[model samples]
Target chain A: MVRPRYFFSETFISLRRNFFMGFTAITTVAITLFVVGFFTIIVYDIQGIISSVESEVELAVYLEDEISEELKDYIEKEVLSWEETDSVNYVSKDQALERFREQNEGSDILKEIEGNPLPASFEITLSSPEKIDQVALRFYDKDGNYIEGVNDVIYGKNYVNKLFSITAIVGTIALLIIIVLLLAAIVLIFNTIRLSIYARRKEIEVMKLVGATNWFVRVPFLFEGFFEGFVGSVISIILLYFVGNFLLIRGERVIVDTMRIKELAIVGSSGVVLYVYIGVAVLGGLIGILSSAIALRRYVKI
Target chain B: MNMIEFKQVSKIYEDNTVALKNINLEIKKGEFLFLVGPSGSGKSTFIKLLIKEIEETEGSIFIAGRNICNLKSNRIPQLRRNIGCVFQDFKLLPNKTIFENVAFTLEVIGKPVYEIKIQVPQVLKLVGIFSKINSYPHQLSGGEQQRVSIARAFVNRPPILLADEPTGNLDPGTSEGIMKILSRINLIGTTVLMATHDRNIVNSMRRRVVELEEGEIIRDQKRGVYGD
Candidate 1:
């Protein structure tokens, strides 16, 4: 039978006896988790902003001035039929000219024009911004020729390409950094546990000599490691709550003020942050347990 | 039945230093024997082998008719559970109280709390340290600490007890006190094997004596003194 009372009492006693070592281990875990949490929040917020921006990307297919009403309706319907197309609205020449006039109000350049040079076009929004290039290609034929009655398809090709590449690079770098931080945390925790074990080598020898099973000798240390990790993670989570809120509030204000957006959801609702906190705490505990197991393998010989 | 048997047992360390040469010895149940040797002799090695702390380079050993040479690693704890051990340093946990130090033996073996409550005080009283049950090891004198150590070893009432220089650090008066406790434990029908260099302790007891030199037993005699 496993005696939980004994294990818990032993864990607490040892933790108290080696207060300095325990303190060092807890502090190490807390600092590492805090840094990692900060980076995670940053990456999540950046991805949120990028995705919001990507949603605004659209494709504009300019039409011939003399195209038949039937051809215009056909073009609109065809673009809407594609799975990537979210919506397609036809803008007549008059509507296009009116929009330009409104945009360039109080400017002499609009008054200098005699007749409307703006072409009628179909403004298309896609379900997925990544498929904009492929959807735009559908406007052309086998020889790279524009389809009949279609003049040109423009989706700011250069800008979309740059955005995609930037997102990919940011994602790769963030993943690599998190991986390196996790490995470093594991190694440092392993060393601290090894030191603590070394300090109590005599205790272990005595325990073994008295016929304590290997697990009987090991369970308390494992509990110690887990407690350190759990406490450390709670500290980090509390710190992250304050720090994340401060930075995100300022960040939301900046984005809203400059970009004229009504609200910027940096890391989604509070519910998502709660889940992230849970994940970090679990990760912290697993690391502590793993490091303790590794350190004990060499020290707690039966 | 023999409590311990060593057949041509030898332990040669990795650096080619032989700690115990090919040797044979048998100890019967309830026997009290003293292993006498100088510092470099195989006294410590013999105790270590019985507990399976280190494997012998050759030959076999049996404890209670079980060959421990091929004993599985996981079963070693079971083997040790039947054998109590005492050391020269009196390896009591510094952080635990006298009561806790003795109670630890029963705790590791999954004994019930009620049993621990009854047995710990019983053993501590036997070693004459019941008055200091609440005191920590560091707070006690050398002899008091050794008494607590003996209580811890004998608490579970194992069949065999091995004491490796249990009085090596105590004065002659304290050593006599420790020997008295060991003799009392042996009187309860527990086989006792003690290794020591104290000539007075060996001479006064006059039990069976096995003397070792240079990793080999040079003398084995009944009703022996410290020497021939």
Candidate 2:
């Protein structure tokens, strides 16, 4: 059998002969990888924003003016009995009045209210912050309707649920984008390899005619594809680093400022990025070579 | 002993066109055989079958001792290496240097670079193309390119050389020059099977001639001169 060096030399010569087509193919692969990379950043950015908002809201339960102080104390103990309640802070009418007055610091209308008209209230904080709705249900009146005087129960329900749903939707959309981009990458690589093979179709046919074994003809094209992909992937990873940094500068908190996000895009996702770059480059090259090799199946006569 | 033996070979193209009909012939080693016919008279079809380019419709073609008709498709390349073919178009690889083109057959067959380095130039010299070793096919004249094609065929030292209208594009002088090269190779004991209609070439060479008419062999004789 001929040595592998011979096949590599031929493949190298073929690549040099049609440098432009190979360049174009590499460019196509790079673009596909970039699209996949960019959208990944966007998906991460959106998710970070939503989780930040979920950490702050709490539910407030208002008491009726007619309810006796003893019953109010009993309700406070009952509220604390639930495992879901993180903490309960009680405020008397006078304390509520004082707090309202303090909040309206510069307003003269605060002095016009001669009496302490505010009701006592309980500020409910939940363990999960996500179960605000169920906790609010416990604040219902005897008739089982929403309490009349309860101004608001603001414990993280809206924010948590909203972020959760939005993240789910965005996550799905991002996944769809990734899948579509991946498919496009494969097709593009396949076509590029196919065209490259077509460019050297005669050479391949001649090789077959001269009694070159199947591997003899196949190895070089595979190498060409691999080289193309390797080069393209290197170019892609370099571009992604700069681009990722630019996005971070434009403000992705996930992109730390101390890190020149552009420079760090490569380093920040170092582990994932390396895997992606090498995996993609190798994948791109293999796909490109295999496509053409397979296409040559019918045309390579004895 | 006969090096090539065909027993009732026929070929029907995929398009249903009958290209060869019941061809039975023998080609001796160290002898030059010419296959002659008009257009569409199965000359090319016969060559294709011998090289395993196209399968026989219903027949057996034996090269050396092996029946090529029964060989598997993957084995065709192996069969082709034993036979050298010169196409009408002088199908030299446009991208390759004359030397590289010539050496390709040997290279594909897993010959060592050192051997290729030695034999390729020898074959090119044999075809009077040693001077144009570095030249691409397009840079050479049609005749010169055909010489490169011939050199490429013989570089591997194939047992049989098949020339399909090798001089189809050359003038009479170039054709005579090519014939001289073939005759020289034949003198050195390489079997040759060429197809042509040039009567002058046939008469002057006085080699064995196999004539095909309407897909059937009409004549086969020693020292034949373009027999009808």
Candidate 3:
């Protein structure tokens, strides 16, 4: 029933008195949340990269040279209608030749040819990379009676399977590590807040002896815990901002050029980054409140 | 009218140690009473029971006509606020100044700032330590600290003041000053109950004495000496 200002001042005084303990708590919370934020960005980027790689696992069906453009259109329509198909694109012989030339930039072997030798092909991409073999077999049936205008199906059999397995393993490991790290962060923060409360046992005893109600004794510690969490979260968010900007400055070129992917941009858009910061701050505040509640329970008797 | 009453109160600990036997006693309003007993003779237990610090194993206790035995656990703070208590060790917050320590009781009970500002200095003056209001408990001597503690307890003007050996840690001269202050407080119609083993103070004051032995009262006398 004490005045609201008294509770706040008490909390502030306790936090000041135990400055070293409070600082240690804040530092521990910040480091834990920093690691968590780092892994969060990395995991998100890795998933982006994985999905991009998965989309790249497509089947190219080369057509017979004599097949009419109408037949190629029919094949494209049929592939597009399949349940497993994500998209179907028909590449003409000229377009295929252009792509080949661009891929092998300095090669003059194409100039020696009399006419365009590359066959027009249908590029079939599936909704899931794992369904590539099954959908590929639909075109070349068990009887080996291949579709009329189709010449051959070219798909990476071993490479696609290996990529799929590796991505699954990596995702599982990343998720497991994040869970473990978060648990450790909570325990460390809880213990630090508890130690701070323990240091003021005598003060707490005096407060109770003077007829302080349970909430009067406990709310101050709760506020202290909450402040620690919020401050720690702010520190971590600031560190993350700098690290994000640094990555954008130093590693942007390598990330873009080597990976041949734009998904590796640090922190994504400004709005999304802001949300991450807010999320971490809220999480830290919650940790502070919860840990304070738990820590003060032993010493705060009614 | 009786300000404090005990009805067959018995407190037995978890290990079957009898702290207070089935006993009954009463103190009228505005009377100063002394509880005298040896260390293991339930004097502390009696004070603790009155404050609801420990629940009685059997029987009822009434403070100012309210049966505190049936009071809810959460309401104990409300009960405690109506009764001021002083301790043997002078439990003052070491870091807080004497003024802060005195004003803390009012603050905890949610008194206004203006009221605290008015009452704290007045009570500190009455306890004869107004000049040292800004001094911390560690900076003050034992007598000064006990006075600060007394100032805190009486600042709220609770109807009953329980001093559990208030002068236990002070010298004889200092003890006399504390007793005088307590007696003055009692004269102003605040009921005072002091538990002590000091024979000289008991003989000099010759107040209403309730002597206990083996968790039972053996004597209750008006203006009684230490051995009477």
Candidate 4:
């Protein structure tokens, strides 16, 4: 207890003499942590959006001209009975011609057409957008062969591809920023510990002269780093919560008008935010402590 | 048998500068030993070798029946805890008060809180620095700072205390005071090893002396006096 008291006292004294360095270090920690927190938010939210969008696409199938009305009705019933299909709409050839004629009434090509050559089609909505490709592949397969009654099936493949690409870019950029900031935090911590050790050179030398072991002298310094890291992490967390609330909750509501995210959850319901913050904090503290240990070893042999 | 035995110890720098060469010596318990030599005569290197600060290039050093020369790097800290040391700079912690400086040694070995509180003050009082317990290193005079430094060294009560030119930077009066304190500590049964070139303080003490010449022990005597 006396040893820990003495070590704590020493840490406090060093904090006084090197207040500027300590302040610089905490600020560096806060900024790095904040960047990591903010970018992590963007990364996760964009991923959620990508998943939502990916699950939304459905296929549109246009029928061939030779399919009779009876077979058409049968195919419709079969597609509807399947658990995968949500809803299907049929347009008779005559109805399709009427609809197309209504849409292109202002066009000269519609006026010039003597008879409607366009085929009727089925606009199919599936239970899941991910199944669009599966349904498209199965569209003409019947009795282990092509049905020959359906035309091309189209869905949004390129949009899902684009969303994934965007997500990848965000993750890459976030990771790069975290690496740079973490390195900066380490350098700052190294210099802070170095300066503190420099200030106590005489005292450290005396500890050496008095038969104190090297680690015995070093425990106090290691404690100092731990204190800084723990405290800095706390401050960073508080700041991140406020920023997240402002930007994601209230700020997003003003722009989108129906944002349903809850209070930006300090201990988020998803648990991911909390874990991410703690992981970054622990990482920051550990780095600070290890860097200080290495730097202090050089200057304080005792 | 001697408490410390050096057998043909030789230390050469990486650049091939020989610090100690073919050196052999024994230091006995309860003996207040003085090593007198000029600068660069391997006095510091000799002390460094005893604690294994720097390893001897050629031979061995035996302390307490153990040939410490072969001790691994990890064991050096424990070996040093048994041997207290002081240097010319007075080496008192500038940031800490006099009391904290004295308590530092005991704290290193994980001493109990109650024990530290009592021991620190008692040691400071013994060194006559109890009045200046709260004084920082810069606030006190060199003599008082050295006294605090002394208190810190003896607080752990290591059986052997090594002083390397402890009074090299002090005036004659302060140096005499330091010698008197060392003598008092020696009277209490702590074996002391002090290296100095102060002729006046040396002649007055009349203790055992070992003189070194170019990394060699040229003279040794009991009831030793100041000499060439």
- Top of the candidates by DockQ: 1
> Which 10 consecutive positions of candidate 1 chain A have the poorest summed lDDT?
A261-270
As for lDDT, the candidate ahead, 1 or 2, is 1
**DockQ of model 4 vs. true complex:** 0.51
Cα miss at B121, model 2 (Å)? 2.4
What's the TM-score of every candidate structure?
A: 0.94, 0.78, 0.89, 0.84
Candidate 2 residue lDDT tens string, A64-85: 7777767778878988999988
True-contact fraction per candidate equals: 0.69, 0.79, 0.54, 0.54
List, residue by residue over B27-140, the lDDT tens digit for candidate 2: 888889999989999898888888776778898888897787778867877888888888889767887788888878887887888999999878888888899999888898
Model 1: colliding residue pairs? none
Q: Rank order by TM-score, top first?
A: 1, 3, 4, 2
Residue ranges of candidate 3 with Cα displaced over 4 Å = A62-75, A92-120, A126-153, A161-168, A262-270
Question: Candidate 3 lDDT, tens digit per residue, A78-156?
Answer: 8888899988888989999889889888878866767888998889888987889888887885688788898989999
Q: How large an RMSD does model 1 have?
A: 2.0
Instruction: Give the higher-TM-score candidate: 2 or 3.
Output: 3
Superposition TM-score, candidate 2 onto the true structure:
0.78
Q: For residues B129-209, what per-residue lDDT tens digits would candidate 3 score against the true structure?
A: 999988888989999999999989889999999999998999999999999999999999999999999999999998999
RMSD of 4: 4.6
Most accurate candidate by lDDT: 1
TM-score of chain A for each candidate?
A: 0.95, 0.68, 0.81, 0.71
Can you tell me the DockQ of model 3?
0.55
Candidate 2 chain A, run of 10 with poorest lDDT: A258-267
